[model samples]
Target: MFTQAKLIITAVVLAALIGLGTWWHLSRVHAAEKAVHAHYAVVLSEIREKTAAAVTAFRATETAWRSAIDKEAANGQARIDLARHDAAGARTERDRLLADVARYRTAARTAQHSSAPTAGPTTGDALDLFADLFSRADARAGELAEFADAAHAAGLTCERSFDALSRTKPATVQAPQSNQ
Candidate 1:
């Protein structure tokens, strides 16, 4: 009976020790898991901050480039409008001068038939007007050509800026996978 009692006590003590050891091990594991989770949270927070900053910088750069392109386009359009206005004015003036020449020619023919010495302005005056009109038309054409060249240059610059913007990489955030 004494030996049985001793053996029973010993078995109880061993079982208690084993339970205590298991509890201690489980607590340590839980602590380690908590520490790991805290570390991951800190890293994730840093990543989010960096990603947000990158996005902001990218947006600012994009806005600047777009603004520059728009300004260039507007300037080119203004130049084109000015050129058109000048060309239209030149055309109207040329037409008016041509009509004046025709009238003068008709008047001179009528005067010759009627045996009159006086007609209209001298031929030199008509020739001078025609030459001046031709010079102005040529100048207007040159202005139009310059406007076209400027517009093409602006278009090319805008295209290059757009291409650069497109090539820029966007910010990305990758989520951690769950073990479960």
Candidate 2:
């Protein structure tokens, strides 16, 4: 004979496992996310360094071009072109990185704050956490899509700019003829 008490007990046990599994999965996801964030931080630092170098190089070339032209006649269109290309590429990369950071921040926040809905067990003491977990997972999925788009666009733009910059000639100014 099926008894109400037995059925209730069975339901509670099932709910407990569901809650535990949800917690475990979410914990694993959080760990993986932390690793991803660490890797991204390193990459972001590298990107910043590369962008700064590109900017410095561009500025130096600009200064040289200005001084050369001001002192004597010099055409440094190639250098100017290259500098423009570098700046544009850096801007694209920085923008993409910012986008990725925004997505990650949103995901982390959602994970930390969101909670799953629950069915009140007969004991009414333990709450269901799986609902919130599901919500967080959905949020992460959305964030991942945005991150992927930014990465793809940034990669394509960087590749194109690098190709263009590589083909450009280093601008040179011949010393003005001196009738000494």
Candidate 3:
């Protein structure tokens, strides 16, 4: 009876120890799983945040790029408009100069045909009038040349600006951060 009693007591204690060890091991496993889940959550949250930031930065860059394009387009258009205006003015001046040249030629031809016979007051007056007409024609020609030069310069400047604008490249988008 005493041996039987000792065996039963030992068996009960062994069962209790087994149950306690299993509970402890299960609790440890549960804690490990919880920690893993928490780490994954943190990593996922970081990834999401980085993605959001990258998207925002990309949008801002796009907006800036668009604005720059718009401004450049406007500037280019303005340059073209100015060049056109200058060209028109040059044309008008050239036409006026041509008309003046025709008038001067006609006047010279008429004067040559109607020269005075003797050196009298009429002859001196005719000479003075011819001199004044020649001077005025020379001044008009100079003005026409200046207008041509200015128009050419303006056209070249506008073309250069257009070429520069075409050559310009937009800024590249930055790569997003690694989620590792």
> Which candidate tops TM-score?
1
TM-score against truth, every candidate? 0.61, 0.35, 0.57
> How does candidate 2 fare on TM-score?
0.35
Q: Candidate 3: where are CA atoms >4 Å away?
A: 1-12, 113-180
| Best-matching candidate per lDDT | 1
- Reference-based lDDT, each prediction: 0.71, 0.58, 0.69
Tell me the spans in candidate 1 whose CA falls farther than 4 Å from its real position: 115-180
> Please, what are the lDDT tens digits per residue for candidate 1 over residues 1-180?
999999999999999999999999999999999999998897788778777877787787777667666765776667666767766786677678667766766776666667745567555456557766766776676677666766765676567656655665554545544444
lDDT of 2 by residue, 1-180 (tens): 378888999999999999999999999999999998987787777677767777777776667655544432212334444545655575566567556655765665565457554464322121124334544565565556555555555565555455545554444433333223
Sort every candidate by lDDT, greatest first.
1, 3, 2
Quality of model 2 by C-alpha lDDT: 0.58
Better of 1 and 2 by TM-score: 1
TM-score, cand. 1? 0.61
lDDT of 2 at 70: 42
Candidate 1 clash pair list: none
TM-score of 3: 0.57
